[model samples]
Target: MFTIRKATVADCDLINRLAQQSFPATYRDILSPEQIDYMMDWMYAPANIRKQMEAEGHVYLLAYNPGEQPVGYVSVQPEGANTFHLQKIYVLPSCQGQHCGRFLFEQAVSYIKSVHPAPCLMELNVNRHNKALHFYEHMGMRKLREGDFPIGNGYYMNDYIMGLDI
Candidate 1:
């Protein structure tokens, strides 16, 4: 069984730890160790996660298995009057084949529908080479454009911007 819950401020530590394990594992073959380490520290530092929740209005949903272990998590940030940015989504490496990602995504969509209740757009950026593009496409998101986003420290994320109408 699986359960999804809205993350609280106290969940920062858990989110940090989950990102530490999931982020690197997911990108192990695609990113260099240095880049992966840099990105993890940039994005998932406990302080950053806390800031994202408290100050930036990012909503996080955590997925837990029946054993009560967190299996995946996703963060969404409202970007405008009608657009929500899917900032981060990661499923534990061991849990990838179980459709945890799709479940988490559906939960996100359901939350938006409940809270926003208007014609909305959901947007996300995916690394150009990530195979998860197929999953997003299957979920009804389309690639709108591509951009090289600079994340400071001389690193850039080359990504495809994808969008889904909600």
Candidate 2:
């Protein structure tokens, strides 16, 4: 139902807006409001997103329906020569039931394949308490490891690192 396009620096603010819409809702049940706000500002602020595109090697893919109505987004960052990290993937709340998540996920894999045609590793860290953990598992990712990583202000991301070979 949506077309995927590579996001540019100009779309950083839009990406931040989308994150503001999805990130808190995704973590609401598992995280405190303070932590949510902290992460939102830390990871999704427009300046941070701009830096992710400009300085880091992250490549964002935005999903839009007809007339450029945004539906979802996913980002892949190359790590080393044979591995890619899925840094972010989300479907807007309004589009949750429409299977956009799977679409975006497959698109991410496809994007990775396009860039590294040879077999490579794709990894993502999912919150241990997040329901999406099962989604990642069902999509054929296996838990590579788990860890509690400190972010700042006494907050930690208790996450399961999952991986798939592509």
Best by TM-score: 1
Assess the local accuracy of residue 95 in candidate 1 as a C-alpha lDDT between 0 and 100. Answer: 91
Candidate 1 stretches greater than 4 Å from native: none
Query: Which residue pairs in model 2 clash with each other?
Result: none
Candidate 2 regions with alpha-carbon error over 4 angstroms: none
Error of 2 at 148 (Å): 0.3
Query: Worst lDDT window (10 residues) for model 2?
Result: 63-72
State every prediction's TM-score relative to the real structure. Answer: 0.98, 0.97
TM-score of 1: 0.98
| CA lDDT, every model vs. true structure | 0.93, 0.93
lDDT of candidate 1 at residue 91, scale 0 to 100:
96
Candidate 1 lDDT, 79-102, residue by residue in tens? 989999999989999999899999
